[model samples]
Target: MPHVNTTIIIGAGIAGVHAAESLRNEGYQGQIMLMDRDSQMPYDRPPLSKEWMKEESDNANILLRNPAIYEKLDIDLKLGVEVTGIDSQRKTLDTKDGSSYEWEKIILATGTSLRTLALVGDDLRGIFYLRKMDDAVAIRDHMQHVKQAVIIGAGFIGAELASTLSEMGIDVTIVERSSYPMENIVGRQASAYFLDLHKRHGVQVITEDAVTQFHGEGKVEEAITAEGRRIPCQAVMIGVGVIPNTEVSVSQLEIDQGYVVNAYGETSVSDIYAAGDCTSWPYQGASIHIEHWDHAVNHAKTVAKNIIHPQSAPYTYTPYFWSDQYHVRFQYFGHAKEWSKTVLRGSAETDAFTIFYLDAQDIVQAAFLANQPKHALPARRLIQQQKPIDTQALADVNIALKKVPRLQGESNTSV
Candidate 1:
């Protein structure tokens, strides 16, 4: 209950940095200390596996604020330091180097880690997982001499890397454990589209496959599947998924798959907050954990506002996400777990389209679009308002998104 003056934030990635900025924007003129395990300034991680792999020089392009901005904002950044433990009672943290710091409030934005494949030969020389800038640089260098690569898992990272390698003239084979790539995400239809995209781009896509063991003497040379099939390759990149980075055991903190928090990003423990991939945020009246870049930024701002001025407003926003693959940009918003209808507004064959998921009452629950971003803005607005729209008007391909009549319903849910 003491006055909060110094706020220490762990992890200097997107969430941490943005939270600091948000705190300043919210008029929190306090002592802000940002720490990171990495030795460099906070840089963008999303581009590491894409543009960074194309040119080694791109590795230096880290997402950061101007150095003068830190001084202007009065933020003390501690790079290359690891937080060992959190003493919630004393409101202090122990650093890995046997140092400690106290704070009136704290925020944990530790993020997540790439899930490693459990198989023999996993520690071989040519086995790799692209999660950091160093990993991408190493993989790009290896690709120069490696003619073939067997990528384990076909999630976003694996699929994007496969596309990048294929563009570089490298023969890439994606060995996915699931029935289809991204089937668990955008559903079977989208997965089929990706399958054809990869195949047309000269990349082999394997499905319903599990790697029994990696076959190599001193270096990774092949991946042996459970079906006795051998995929010959020189390098292996595993992108199964990621796990939340929450190791500190605090009994007062609620945690499900991640740190459970309410709409305001508040934890059960007072003065303690969480955001980014490590926090489970309230969405659609339920706690939903998102690992998207936009969620991290938006959550940081919300947590910052709540921390600085708790009386500002409710933390509410529609969930929106996007990913750039090949020449197409896929964007999605809102939740679709219980939606009953899926309508298309544009032609999927032309690679320019939008899919809207509507509930039984004609309320838009979610909308996904490929290459068409204009509809997403309005779709997000409708979802946030829980607005009911005319089915025919929304489905009409010729009607402009804004031109559609405003949703009218006395039973619309409050955002």
Candidate 2:
């Protein structure tokens, strides 16, 4: 562990803020500097699609911390600053404004950028992507003159936006290339519940179809599907997905799908670490990259501890994430890259169910709970322990999650 007297953290999202806080909390007396390109204070991004977009809330309500809190914490927060280049040899980075800073250690939490559709009329006026607060505000402003909207991609953002727009009395039509919303993550069985939920809310969900082009004079007025189905809409919101922001790395750091890191959040280059959406770390025998809020917070804390204590324990927390759409909350834990079998508890039609995804070895890999958030915590433990489960017991709602039988000598604890 090289001496880290001064630390520089890039990107002021939840991960960076929490990393800075962890350094101070863990008794690191080094000078800390946090920089971000956004001019506004760091705010929560999850609410941008739901609560913040629906209501007129004060900026402070979304802020991760008050402006004065940074001053008290002795954190030099530089907002609206873009880091242009990084020189690993010099242990320094240059900003867009011709400013350079040297540091003993650097942490990258650049997060992600919203993916856009490159159709013929993609540059049209009323199309929007919801990733930041300003984007949400612009969508709300545009909604005043529009009666209908076509949302491309039925991912979490698109689904949440569909629900929000429907609640605001705007007719919403969701166009998805997959068979159902979030099919890749939650699988077909669980996704059907969300499909039904959207239908009940009066939102038209067009599945197994994609928007081939957008047509209008200047602004988006209609979306042309691949099947030649023309749907007229006054506005459009694209939520295909997001790509990790790796431009700031300047081609100097080791990169794969994302910045490659170890279980301790240490990048290939010593004294350099990364967290949040911009990193893919080793977990449960796989190199996985998670873009959820909980992973960001946990990764930051683990990285902070590893920086202060070189021999700190590796990060082993099970990945967790949740989404809110209509009146239901969907929570998931663990990662199931591939599952041989799926065991269901309760009925999806009732909108109250928990799903257990088991791998080929019959070990619980991941679990998804819809409208039943309490099972998330226990499900996480089951994944972490890699406990083999009886399929029948897993499917029985009468058998509590804690009472499920495990393999041989493995014991289940009450959660």
Candidate 3:
């Protein structure tokens, strides 16, 4: 084993913090430093859009690890510290506080920043974007005084936030440019289910429209649509998307959709690696970037292991993500750009359904489960195998999912 004198991990989010813990568990006695700009201890992000957005929930339970764990692991956790630049040649980093740190190995897990709207009055006080815990805190504080909200996007974050606000008895009007909510990711039919879910809960959804301007004296009072229609709302939440935080890269690392990395999380430069949402890694035959809680945890484990065991197997796992809205729990596994056919299992009307997207060869490319969470794992395995599936049997709910046979392999165990 190569001797690692000291390791530095940038970004104290889930990925960076987990990397430090994994390194210690792998028997590395070297020094580990986890740094982040946020002063708060590392906390789970998923809750920020849901429970933490509510008035009752606090940060008490969202912490990823207790302070005692970091002390016991002897990990140097420096919060509220901003890393200014990285000198790849010197293998050292400079902080904004005029301090330089040297490391034998470095992991760049700097995540992402929210993409803001370029419309007029974007800097208005009540218009907000949720990305960090502090952002959520601000939104929660603002949400208390507002009776209605205008959400600018219909992505996962937008949908989840709409649901949270609706549960708080605030009227939500979701403005989406897409024809249907989550249309780009889950397809039209599945998106309709989410749209219907929101409408049933008394949330108004405006499709094929966008908010182009905010009008108010100081705080936002109304959102003007591109069609010239003015929607009155006290609060506005923008969930357009997120951009990778590559400022630290400074042309030092290759970047595409994000920081380019190999399957083992190795960047173009040696002794440097990147994981989490900031990384774009090679998958099957494509370079894919994933921004999900599970991906962060899994990628950190892979990168940490590869750092310890360079000759280990490459990182390979099916992508999985879930969203909770109202009473529906939506789960999806795998990724697909274009699928030839979509096979439906169960009844969509009853809200218990699973859709399997298949390619031209009838191989499972992706699967979306709504309210039927039990089939999530089985759907992931089908994608991993990439074997042709029985379309007829897949549509028949009477036939067990595990009993569905593959074109070349035996029947998978029934879930």
Candidate 4:
């Protein structure tokens, strides 16, 4: 670590800043230059669609850390600097500002690029995407004069925006291309819960439909769906999805869905590493790219730890993320793309429940909790342990999550 002269971190979002802070905490004496293309100070992103959009945040309280803290940590915070190229062999970086810097190590925390629409109204004035702080600010300002809004997609961002805009008394309509949006994340049984939540909030959700055309003069006035539906809207926000932002000029750097990295966040090129959403690291013997706040924070810390002392720690934490829509908040723990079946605890009807995604062997792969605070810790622990679960006991509200692994019975359990 003493030989390490400088550590250049790209992208100053949650991952980059935390990586800098974690480097200091891990006793890395090297010069840490944190850079981002964004001019704004580092801010949390989850609130951008929910809290920041719903209310007026004067760019003060939205900060991820206080302004003084960056100075205190001696992290050279470069807000508007964008790295254009990376010379891995020479260990130097070229920036868009015509600046070149020599670095012993580099960490890529570039995050993801927000997915945008390519329809006829793509150039419309009122069309927007929510990814950065400034995007939310613009949307918030325009919302004052907007009477109707059409949100495309039913993912976390789109759904959250629909809820916030609808609560503000603006007519909100969501056009999702999938018959059941978010089915891949929450499964079909729980997917119905989300639709009902939006419907109850008076959000006109049009499923299995995609916006094909945008009709307007200079600004957007109406959206034409693939299903021959015409909807009038003053503003449009798209939340389709995002792809990894891997734009480094290095040709040899391995990339599969994201910048390929090891468990210790070491990239293919020596002295170069990557973390957060831009990295695909080995997890449970499979390479996976996770784009979530919790993953970014924890992965950055682990990368920092390894940079300070190589192979000292590995990122093995269970994946987790949360979404806030309307008055309800949903917290999901672990990751399960496919499961044998979803074991439900409590009732989705009662607005509180936990869905466990178990494999064929009845092992806990992941769990979804809707306003279930008591089960959060236990569910996380169970998922981490990867122990065989008793479906009946797990689903039974009487049996605690921690105890479900211990007591396995064939008896049918009811909420």
Candidate 5:
């Protein structure tokens, strides 16, 4: 292990905080400094889109860890300190508050920034974006005064927001650019199912159209679509996407839309590491980037372990994601870009279904479970094995999914 006088972590979100905690768990006694631009305590971001918007909560409610835990862990937490630049050679960083600090090692978990619309009426009132706690606080406060909401995108954030607003008795009209939103993640059929689900819940979904401009004097009174459809609403939430917050210039630090890293979470620069949404790490022999709560927690922990034992600790992460929409829980286990076949285990109308993605060899690459808690954990564990499963047993609801997977070099029969 390298002798470290101090370790400074940028971005005090889940990734940065977890990295600091995991460092202590890995038996590190060196000085650990956790810093972020936001002044508030580190909080869970996933809840902000759903529960935080639906319920009444304060800053303390969304905190990732107890306030006193940092004192016990001996972590130095610095808030509202915006890191402007990084000197990879000097092992130091500069903050917006005109303070400079040097460290033996550094980790960048800067996360992401919300992508906003740059149209003519973007600066109008009642237009918002949800990425941080402050944003959620503002949106929640505004939701009380608003009767109708027009969501510009139909991604996870958009869908979750629609569900939350609907539960709050706010009329929601979703304007999606893609006819089948999130088809890549949930598949085409499930995408259609989601559209129908929202419609059945009294959500007016306007697909194959986009908000071109807002029409109002000072406040946004109406949203004009590209197809000339005008939507009147009290509020508009934009959830197009997010851009990686990796602006610091580090010499030879490779960045392909994000800070590129290996399974070890080590960047091209030595004594410097990165994780979370701001990184593109290796997975399944290829490099990919994931932006989700589970990925941040798992990736940061793996990175923290490798920081102590750089070579021994490898991140064998099975990407996992889940969303709570209305009364149903949606979960997707593992990652898969392409698959030869898909097996459906349950009916979609019943709202308890699992769609398994398999390659040419019939090995499960990924599985999407909708309101199927019994199959989620087991599917997550078995997908990592990359073994073929009995199709007949997998499709049968009566058969246990745990017994459907065949061992290595076994016949095409369930174990």
Candidate 6:
């Protein structure tokens, strides 16, 4: 291994913290520093939508590692430091506070930011977007006084937050521009169950309703829909979507909306790697950029290994995502862009079932389920190996999913 003098990682989120830990595990005795623009310690971003947003004190649980771990591991933690620019040729970074640091290698773990809608009254008070700890705190505080919360964009985050607010005795309304919530990720059918779930939980779900503008005096009192319907609410939670945090300063390094990386997390600039939501890399069947929590941790591991071993293993990652909404635990594995055939292994109406998306070849491309994570295990393995299974056995709910035999010795690389 080439000697690395100093390794500096930007953004002390899951990716940065895990990369530092992985390096130490691999016997790297170099100076490791994690920098975050936020003042808090490295923390898990998932809880921002659930626990952290409900109870203010719950932020303690989100820390990636306790303070002792950083001291014990000898990681130089630099919180509240923002990297304003990256100089690839000089192998150095400039911070917003007029400071510069040189690094032997740099890992960009700066995750995505929330993409707010450009509505007419977007600047109105009580209009919020949740993506950071600060955002969560503000939302939580406002929820304590507000009786109703209207969430725009019915994605996972939006849905989860709506469920959370509903559980707290707050009236919640979710407006989705799509025909159904989570259609982009979970497909329209699975998203339909999600809609039913929300309705059962007393959440008013308005699908295919686009918010044209917000209306209020000094604060957001109501949302004006495209169809000219005004929904009354004290606050608006915008969860439209996210965009990669690659800024113009690093544009020369090569980017296709995100920092384009190979299977090894290598950017166009040598010794520069990116992981987490900021990275777009090749996975099992296609090039994808996943924003799930696990991807941030796992991809950071690959980036760390690649930094030490340039010829890193191919990042054949299985796309996985989960959401905690009401009493349902929705989990998905593998990629499902658009399924030609949809098969259900169990029942969705009963709320405990798995949905399988298969291509014309009958190979399972993706699987979705609520409260049935065990079924996801085999599907994940099959997707990783790119193996084909018996379709009849897969679709039978009475049959044990694991009992299905794999077509051995098939050398198909696509899953």
Whole-structure CA lDDT of model 1: 0.81
Candidate 3 off by > 4 Å: 1-4, 250-252, 409-415
- Model 3 / residue 402 / CA error / Å: 0.9
lDDT of 6 at 15: 84
RMSD of each: 2.1, 2.6, 2.8, 3.5, 2.7, 2.2
Error of model 6, residue 86, in angstroms:
2.2
**Steric collisions counted per model:** 2, 0, 0, 0, 0, 0
Error of 6 at 106 (Å): 0.8
What TM-score would each prediction reach against the true structure?
Answer: 0.94, 0.95, 0.96, 0.96, 0.95, 0.94
For model 6, give the RMSD to the true fold: 2.2
Over 1-415, each residue of candidate 5 has an lDDT whose tens digit, in order, gives 3246588889899899999999988998899999998998899888898777878665678899998999999999999899888887766788998998888888889999988888768788889999987788888888788998899899999999999999899999999988899988768878988999899999999999989889788888899998999898889999999999898658699998789988788889987889899999887777888898888888899899888887677888788889999999999988878888889999999988999988777788889999999898789867877777777788988888888857465322221
lDDT of 2 by residue, 152-235 (tens): 998888999999899989999999998877777888888887888999999999998999998999999999999888999999
TM-score, prediction 3: 0.96
- Candidate 1 residue-wise lDDT, 98-136, digit = tens: 888889878888898988767887888888988876787
Clashes of 1: 2
Candidate 6 ranges with C-alpha deviation above 4 Å: 1-4, 248-252, 407-411
In order, candidate lDDTs are: 0.81, 0.87, 0.87, 0.87, 0.87, 0.82
In model 4, where do residues sit more than 4 Å from their true spots? 1-4, 407-415
How many pairs of residues collide in model 4? 0
Give the per-residue Cα lDDT of candidate 6 at 338. Answer: 74
Better of 4 and 6 by TM-score: 4
Clashing pairs in 3: none
lDDT of 6 at 30: 87
Q: Tell me the lDDT of model 5 at 385.
A: 74
User: 5 or 6: which has the higher lDDT?
Assistant: 5
Q: Tell me the TM-score of model 1.
A: 0.94
